[model samples]
Target: MERDALLQVANFSTLFACMVLKFPQILVLMRARSTAGVSLNSLVLELAGFIVFVSYQMYYDYPPPTYLEYPILIAQDVILLLLILHYNGNMKQSIFYAAVFIGGWKLLTVEKRVIDLAMSLCTFISASSKLAQLQCLWATKDSSRVSALSWGLATYTCLARIYTTVVMTGDVQVLVRFVAMTILNFWVTATAMYYKPSAKKKD
Candidate 1:
């Protein structure tokens, strides 16, 4: 196969892996109806980041993301929003409004600078969320509450980011995000190993 063909195949496989892991994590959250141990701050930041990232893609005329990526991310964000509202006993009208405003602005605007600014903002939000998650794990000394599926997703995301970084010069931001996520994943996984839930306690 030609070099471009090989790159395409790799990208497809990585995208598929990301979708597989991400969807399962969303399903787990939905079925559990409990963000009990999950970090709300992280979720909020992630939603913010995703909004920017998606907008960037749209503005830059990047190829359409896989169908699975869009739906899974939407589902995850919606679920997180609902969980926050329910737990805090606060209607998230403002959050919804903000999402709408930003999304609309991106859709209506044509300037490349505006899109670049959005991407930069989104990247910061994403980093903040990841850092918040790490802090949560460290403070509690318990990674048991984090969804296992998220860890799996991180692993695949790391692999995919590394591949993309090597193949595509424009993907540096994504590569950095994935690298940070991968490191956090290892930390959480190690903490989880030490704090496994006890079967006897459950009974």
Candidate 2:
């Protein structure tokens, strides 16, 4: 009973966090009218990761609670991607990217092996996304527009998902993904904070 209660809390918390996971970033971009410190590659790769993960969960009939947040996260990512493209004055490319992402989503579940392969690569895809963001921060050396709050919230969601994954699914692949995400999210959060103009000003 206690374990079940904990799982519920963790699952709901993760869901809630994911619902607004990208809002801070989105708002920052809108207010600043720039994509200065954000990585378009990271958003694209992260969207791919979300699609594969949710597809894997659905293919295997995993518990809805375990992966429910993914769809919401994907939607938020789409909005973020559109906003990024708009700010970059490359909105015309949105159609091509959407077609590719949609086609990739459908192809992932055409065969059991295909999804398995995709899931196997999901961690790397997701990790690469975070690394891309890190590279953006490193290149810009200014995270004033990066939304550390978004990354910090992402870290929390990943941590919550880790607990929920263990208690609910016990799927090694999912567990590994969450663990790696948690570390990367934390790294991004710290990096963003470290690069803040205020931090530099204080130094």
The candidate scoring highest on TM-score is: 2
lDDT of 2 by residue, 50-144 (tens): 99999999999999998898899999999999998998899999999989999999999999999999999999999999999999999999898
- What is residue 23's positional error in candidate 1, in angstroms? 4.0
TM-score of each: 0.72, 0.98
The regions of model 2 sitting more than 4 angstroms off are 201-203
Quality of model 2 by C-alpha lDDT: 0.93
> Largest lDDT belongs to which candidate?
2
Counting clashing residue pairs in each candidate, in order, gives: 0, 0
Clashing pairs in 2: none
Please give, for residues 1-203, the per-residue lDDT of candidate 1 as tens digits.
58778667666776676556555555655676555556778777776666666666565565563222544565556665675566556665647746774675556447777767766666577768777876776677554456666665666656665665566645666567667666766665555445545411342
Worst-scoring 10-residue span by lDDT in model 1? 194-203
